[model samples]
Target: MSGHGFHVHGPHDHELEHAAHGNDDFASRIAVMTAIMATVGALFGYEGGATQNDAAMFKNEAAIKKTEAANQWNFYQSKSSKQNLAELAMVLPGADAEKYKAKVARYESEKEAIKKDAEKLEAESKEWEEKSENALHQHHRWAQAMTAVQIAISLAAITLLTKKKWLQYASYGVAGIGVALAGLAWFHI
Candidate 1:
């Protein structure tokens, strides 16, 4: 019996004890690797969530801008219709012919101003839509990176259970890919 009050039964038990010690070392190494992978995976996951939130915000803003643009276009159309009615009134031979002509000219100017404003709003709306698309694309990239990291972490867990060096290597390779993807997401590429 040793100081711990435990004794090996025979030479076979001694060999088994040595093998167990070796396995312990391997298990400790796997634990350390798993901790590192989990840390990295958590960080990437957070970034992915943030990017997804940003994408949603941008999409909402784009929708609002588009609605505003549509309203502006509708207003412009109303002005155009008023101008057309004024032109028809001018064609009538009546005491108000001169007045109608003046009204027509005023409506024309107003329509031109309204058209410019509507066009400007439409352009702005398009710009917002483009921004939303870009954010959504970035979100997808971040999500993919997060998925890779999660898969790597799962592989690491499996490697720990199986005590397989090859599986550990595969986990590390997958982790490397996850890190690369995280880098790309960080740069918004």
Candidate 2:
């Protein structure tokens, strides 16, 4: 007891003080490693979600393009039917042959335009489908990266609990794989 006051310290004060100062090197390393892995995992998870959304958007665009192409094709088919009717009118008795010829020509021209537009839309649809596929592939990569990082964090926790040096190394290895996967995802590989 001091003259001014009595300050009683608990028996585990030394251990508590050591922890407060981060004196246990293994524990500090595991803590830092766990924090880093968690951050990386979160980032990977966010990227996976974003990529999934992108894939859905691209797929929707593909579907819209396909519908537009189908409409154009329907218009082309209608023009073909009109042109067939006009050709038949040219040969029918008591019909305006010149007007029918003009009608046929106009329908053919319109059909050509519609065909081109339909083909263009079909190509756009295919492109959108390819984009959607690529986005989905990237999303998978991000998800895999997130999974690896999560595994690493779990390993780090186990290392802290058991004080196993080998588990720490394993955690580091898994974390490296997670980072590599993240890089691959960034490159869209």
Candidate 3:
């Protein structure tokens, strides 16, 4: 019975205080870990979105190039048809035979030029397709990373709820995999 009502802690009180301190420390660790996981998850989500956008852009470019190549082929076919008509006209009666011959020569030269252009367009289209495929592959990797990070975040939440140290470790393992996948995506391999 002290006059100030300030008593010294007994052994039981000391043990309770130590346990409370430990619980607070554990809660702090969980909070810190959750925060870190959330930050990384957000970054992974953003990168996944960006990669998907890049893939879509590349795909659209490929489609455009393919359309251009198709158009060039169509033009080439039309020129070929015209050249055929000119050859037919050249075989006709002698009234305009020389003129038809000159026209046939011009059409042959035009066809040659058109063939070169169409070939160039086809090559360009193939290059675009290759680029698009590469982007898509990278996008898939990024998506996988995003998924792993999301799972890690969920596991972290569960760890907090269940107070399971094993779950926390598992969350870290999943997060590591996510980070690795993100690195792979960066290299676009």
Candidate 4:
């Protein structure tokens, strides 16, 4: 019976052991969670940046198309004016030039409308830019949270390994790397 009796640690020893175990568990959990959060942050950042790039590209394409359409309209108006002049010279030499001038004025009005439409599209594109910035800001916050978790985990690990030289050194190495990664995230990378 004496030999079968369980070995019991004193209250202080038990408490220290418990604290070490708790720190170890907390550190491992936080490390895993930090990895997950970091991955999520990276994905969100990429998606946000891509959306912004797409919006800018769409805006450029729309502007180019609008310009081309306006130029084509101008070309048509110029050709019509030339045809009117030729007809007047051959069929009615004394016809007033104001009729041909009126066609030019209509084309000018159409150009102004096209310009306004392009401006409206650009304004909407600017709104999209703001949305993209918002998304990026959200991603930034997520990254900061993830980094904090990583640092917490590392500190917990360091505390847990305080009594074991080998484990302490290993934890230190791991914590160093985690800290470097967290720094990179915070600084935007």
Candidate 5:
């Protein structure tokens, strides 16, 4: 028994280990192919987890940016209301109309700045959302690749048990598909 937790050799692993050292060429080939497929599956699994984590982080960033954008928009609205009141003050009789006009101008400029900042933050949030979606898509691709590789390994185990040449060929085909999926993941397709 190994010291590592959750590490248990399956019956197929024992058979594969035995076949790997056996004199039968067919068994040896299947064993080697299954070993390679397992390695590829592990790598795909790792990438899938990493991409999922990245997606979560990107989504969190998008949420934060969206909140900041909302805050800026609220600030812009507040400034607009203040500007309207200042304009009304300028119309009141005996009011400091010059001071009210200057206050209105300042509020107008501030609102413009706030509007621009909010728009920029909204764009940033959208960009982060797109990034999160892409990462999720990539994670799905990696998961598919890992699934195919696991199926290939299973087929290899069956081939080893039954000594079926056709099963071996099918396992090879599935392994190729797994590699292709991994390629698609790498390319973000």
Candidate 6:
């Protein structure tokens, strides 16, 4: 049952044996190529995931800045409105009462508009952070899956090159499937 240490067809067996050696070399080459691809895919996936995480962090920082700016604007507007209302009440008295009332009303309206804008900016900051975090999670998942696939492919390639019948039986077609998945992940990254 072994191809080595025995010959049944004399010179023809020698030719067939030489051909099998060539096949073995071809299989080894394939295995090496598969390993290279797997390694590259794993590296790319890892880096892509890390980059996504950095982007998420940046988004969070931006969100924090926006919220802080909005809060500061609101505080400033509230103080200014109160001061203006007090000054107008004292300075106008009975002579320009209606004019003071109109001026105060406009100031109140402007303050309310600024308050709405600050709220809107705060909401937008939260939304941006959430979106960035989601993208980071997706990239992390993709990287993990690709790493597992690459390991599987490397194992399969080793098995194929070694020409162990048991390994072959256990690993046939695995390298192909792993490579395909790796390629898909690479494209995503």
lDDT of 4 by residue, 1-189 (tens): 347886766769987787667656545654564466456445545544554565566556656655655665565566556656654554465766577567556655665665566566556656655555554554454445445445544554555546444554454455455445445545545
Model 3 agreement with the true structure over 37-65: per-residue lDDT tens digits: 78887887787788778778877887887
lDDT for each residue of candidate 1 in 67-175, tens digit (9 for 90 to 100): 8778877887887788789888878766488887888788788878877877777777777777777777777777787788778878888998788899989988988
The CA-based lDDT of model 4 is what? Answer: 0.55
* Backbone clash numbers for all candidates listed: 0, 0, 0, 0, 0, 0
Instruction: Give the per-residue Cα lDDT of candidate 4 at 152.
Output: 46
Residue pair clashes in candidate 4: none
| Model 2 per-residue lDDT at 144 | 92
RMSD of each: 4.9, 2.8, 6.2, 9.7, 7.7, 9.3
Pairs that collide, model 5:
none
Residues 19-107, candidate 5: write the lDDT tens digits.
56668988778878988889889999999999999999999999999999999999999999999999999999999999999999999
Provide the TM-score for each candidate, comma-separated.
0.83, 0.90, 0.83, 0.42, 0.87, 0.56
Span of 10 residues, lowest total lDDT, candidate 4: 141-150
Instruction: Return the candidate ranking by TM-score, descending.
Output: 2, 5, 3, 1, 6, 4
Per-residue lDDT tens digits for candidate 6, residues 29-146, read 5566566667756665776667587767869776786977678586757857675875568575465776666766777777777777777777777777766776665566556656
Model 2 agreement with the true structure over 93-143: per-residue lDDT tens digits: 999999999999999999999999999999999999999999999999999
Tell how far residue 10 is off in model 6, in angstroms: 30
The per-residue C-alpha lDDT of model 5 at residue 57 equals 100
Candidate 5 wrongly placed segments (more than 4 Å):
1-22
- Candidate 3 yields a Cα-based lDDT of 0.82
Question: Between which residue pairs do clashes occur in model 2?
Answer: none
| lDDT leaderboard ranking | 2, 5, 3, 1, 6, 4
- Per-residue lDDT for 185 in model 1? 81
lDDT of 4 at 173: 54
Superposed Cα RMSD, model 4: 9.7
